[model samples]
Target: MSSVQPYVPNKDFIYRAADALADSHLQQALAKAGRGFVDKRSAAVTRVPNFEAMRDRARAVRQKALQDLDIYLLHFEKKVTEAGGQVHWAETPAQMREIVLQLCARHSATRVTKGKSMVGEEVYLNEALEKAGITPFETDLGEYILQLAKEPPSHIVAPALHKTRAQIQDLFLHHHALGERDLSAVEAIVDEARQVIRDRFLRADIGITGANLLIAETGTVAIATNEGNGDLTATLPRAHIVTTTIDRVVPTWEDASAILRVLARSATGQQTTTYTSFFTGARGDTDKDGPEAFHVVLLDNRRSQLLGSEYQEMLHCIRCGACMNHCPVYQAVGGHTYDSVYPGPMGAVLTPLLRHRDGDYQLPNASTFCGRCESVCPVKIPLPDLMRKLRNREQQEARFKGAGYWITKVFCALAASPRLYRALTSIGTKLAAALGARRGRFSKLPLLGGWTAHRDFPAPQGGSFQSQWRRNGKAQPPVGACPAGD
Candidate 1:
């Protein structure tokens, strides 16, 4: 049982969420990144004709890929082998780490530079590299900042979205001795980071990046980055390794193209990334510069088990960060509150599936069910639906804590018998209607005071729905669903 971010141990999700809500610095950081991501994606999508159609195409591509995942993956592996690259399959993070470490050791790698990869985060590759005594450098500006600060990423696309400009300035000033260089302007800060990591790309023996999309038709892996670091990281090193999950494999370059069209627009609101580089395999005799050895390590990590299951739709995510930007809960509490490699709506459904620790189920409860995450998702993953499913499953499994345990047990018991349920609700509603008609709403309740403290709970105007339905005689249920039995 390895943690998602080993450097930072897990904490109680509810407590962390409360802390996140209270922290002013975190509030400032969330306010800065949340609005910008939403606005940029909104503006970018508007500029494209049939953006919704593009999303539909991308969603179809993913669904088709996963539907025939085995065919595409085998085809991808064969293509890689033909192109003078090796493909290694890992069923777990440990196996993936071992595969990568063996690759690094074989290459005699002492220095490694990494592109920003959530797959890398999922496997905790940085921690593995450090434990193996290899010096790993993060080339993405946001990743580099978090690396220097020894913190896990808050957002997937923008890792340091939780850090303010002032905070980054302090990190650089403490870590580097840049003399009299004004690092106040945003451009200056970017320049400073560029200067700092310029040589790591050249000196590194191994470069590892995550695949944004993998093409089975051409045996090519594509990476998209705002910074050109991914290009340098992949090309400059003696060996290149792609650390990605098996779900990234698409059937063809056309399918890959379909996804790429939406990836950048949803991520940074750019039509395309500044550098969307594709690599097939090792450099040939005629090629001047590229990695001598190329490897694509596909980590399963329980993802293959999800195929044909209800949760398989999660595999469609493109890591655009659009869901997080639009998510009210994520905007308020930030990614760190989820305490997983992933955060926000995606993580709420994913973290528990990947790592079901004590508090993992709590993530599904973090949502407001506003459906914003689903609305903004480029792949159209039913995130709210998935989260609701997880929440229901958790309660059914009785995986709750303390007072919540008994409370949920009581509620579930009450809900099991239709007769008891209708009878209890009939009496309760009548009681509330009669008592609270004067005030119209309850300011406090025994168990729901926290909710009532902020807003009044409306008193029921009459008997329960079942009672009213029977009284009406010709009444119908909403949406034409069959009426419940009593």
Candidate 2:
């Protein structure tokens, strides 16, 4: 019942992306955040012997779980009930929010501490909590930073990834009462937030966390976090609730371990998270720790419909941010531009399927087709391929009369005949060459202002491939490397 309605702004990707590209502070933040993740992942996998093999195993585990997802989910539910915990099925975000509110009301919970939950973000759970008169404190540092800023998470793992250190300093100064504390260092900033949230953790009436893996064999919920707050939040409170989607479940402990191995390597480039904790139901009669009541609310939200579809592989995703980290478009503009609870390549594929009315068809065409997303995927979800499929779906459905539809239609017409394509491309190249003769690059152009407005687009130099091939008598370039433009 605690799932929040979508707080994510569903804006046109083109307009928002233009705004993001023009934002200097956001640009700095993206540059700073993007490289660290890429380098760390490279290093982490380099350290592991045959990391590819581990990824293969993880992919197999996920595929197997998805194949029999219903069976595993039922097994998981049975185990939870046997361990004295209840399972609630939420078909929609509203149902999820209602279920959580009822649990909070049952316990008369006024304050709740929460670990990072992407599912919560999907539902805008924090907003719902405030609406319900329950104060929820975010214990994770990244989530806490974003909460203070009153911003939705830009990136999944690093929710505040689009915030520079200076911006964070400003946020803290505005939010906290620090007379003369030296807050120059990143560590100091984190410590200050830790000190602030510590009391909330101890005093909260209930705790809610998202599960990284749900094991059917033991009906155990596992969470992996850099901060130890998840363990504290779950065990310290009188009531514990796990809010997550059904796709998170796996068949057994071993399968969970296999996913974890790649999950760490893919996410943050660590061999393991700083704290990986597991919980089964509530505290036992002889046990002195854990909440008296434990509940798991699993949201379907049409994910079950994707079970046998082309996108079933998407459910295999481990929520690792690797795909976005390696994405050039995301690196350039950052997450908020996508205007989705999920962003980047994964979001480009999933968001449209989940909420088709979000004007997200343009998302599929957001790729350069580098395929880094598929290459780096822990569970190997073919992100680019899925996006391509969505693109085809959009074309078939004739969803919109936007620029993409017309452009794609023109391209398709041209692609049907080599002669027409060659003739048109030759004329187009020569025309572009003549137009840019003064500068050798275009600062702006019709239908291409998205790229040209921010940066220069190098005009065609040598000639179209057809002309060059005909002139050179083969696939070799035309004699001159550069055209007369410059």
Candidate 3:
């Protein structure tokens, strides 16, 4: 395997993954996963008559919560304290890491067992712990695989989905100290993970997890998982910590229930997760297995700036992975191409927002604006619209607002003129088709060398749709009128 690091915003990694993803193997895997997820989601939607209405209601709840975030966050903190838990606020990733490390120090933690929390990933918690000499063990299977591989998450929901069973088997055989045995099946592989990690749960000094939703009214945190890993990570140690973005807060337990109704179904086609546990505080009266101390770290990390902005709707994401599941681009390239902890449609929107790009540019233009993501989002987030806003952000940045930007603006202005647009389109299509006709595809592109390096370019069609429409007496019809026959 290549020693390539997680595809951060580094220009080189982005281009490399874009090139590597062109291989047929990656394409086949992405296509299979994408189509399967969409079909399953469609079937699930059909099963619920009020699915659309439920999404609308979920949207309303999240909107109301975000609109009044300050009020609800304070309410959440008060109740959590009342329930025998302490709340900590982090304004940035550095502060978040510092607080967690101090908490670990307070417990004299030598080893920390962790559940899969993307917020923790966002803060690079494992690295922080390692720097402080605390060994952080990933309890979630997917996370465990990634930790063994020393790789960041490729996809948000399915962290190890990109790795096939064979790869996993190979990883286990090479990494696990157990003597040789059959590793042909998924069950065997899971057994290996469990055998290795089960002891870590009991031996660790602290347990940490990510919260799905934080209920302000009850001061309760919800953890949803298919595996029992989250439970182990939350209960097996003396101290338990939940790291989450401030956006996770819901006004009340009733509102959280409403969101949960859509979260699992949209995520994995389950009406409810196999394990949806609500923890109010640490181990209490008659609670023998839970931790003695509970702490919730609410990370701001640029989110407060996003509150009143056009991209605020993105805060509603429940990490369901629906948008990525249905995205055509993500299907073709997998999550690696996006070059971040977040990937796919939601990543396309959130990565640029968090990373702070400088230019008349953001990377989400990589899409065709199909709007399928928006249609399927359980919380009704307008993903494409937000993606466009990110693009505008690039334009607003001074670094990218120069000559290249003016040229692009001029081209868009020209393209708006129908006569010139059709002429340019006709000429470009003719040239492209002619260039590719000999071999059925263009092996290289003039301006998009990175795009063409690994895959052949699809030739343009002979005629534009608008041209065909105009030739058939469909030109200049009334704004809302039907075709000539109608």
- Residue 308 lDDT, candidate 3, scale 0-100: 93
Which 10 successive residues of model 1 have the least lDDT summed? 1-10
lDDT for each residue of candidate 3 in 1-486, tens digit (9 for 90 to 100): 434245343365356456747666556556546567677777887899999899988999999899889999999899889878899999988999999999999999999999999999988999999999999999899999888878788777789877777667877887887887999987899888898999998799999999999998988999999999899889889999999989999998889988999998888888888999999887889876788899999998788888998889999998999988888777767777776778878888887788664321345776779998898899989999988877676676655366667988989988889789889888877888787777878888887796898897888655666666767646455565666676
Identify the runs in model 1 with alpha carbons over 4 angstroms from their true place.
1-10, 399-423, 437-439, 460-486
- What ranking of all candidate models by lDDT puts the best one first? 1, 2, 3
Q: Model 1 — TM-score against the truth? A: 0.90
Overall lDDT per candidate, in order of appearance: 0.90, 0.89, 0.84
> Candidates' TM-scores?
0.90, 0.90, 0.86
The superposed Cα distance between candidate 2 and the true structure at residue 144, in angstroms, equals 0.9
Model 1 scores what on Cα lDDT?
0.90
lDDT value for model 3: 0.84
Total backbone collisions for each predicted model: 0, 9, 4
RMSD of each: 4.9, 4.7, 4.5
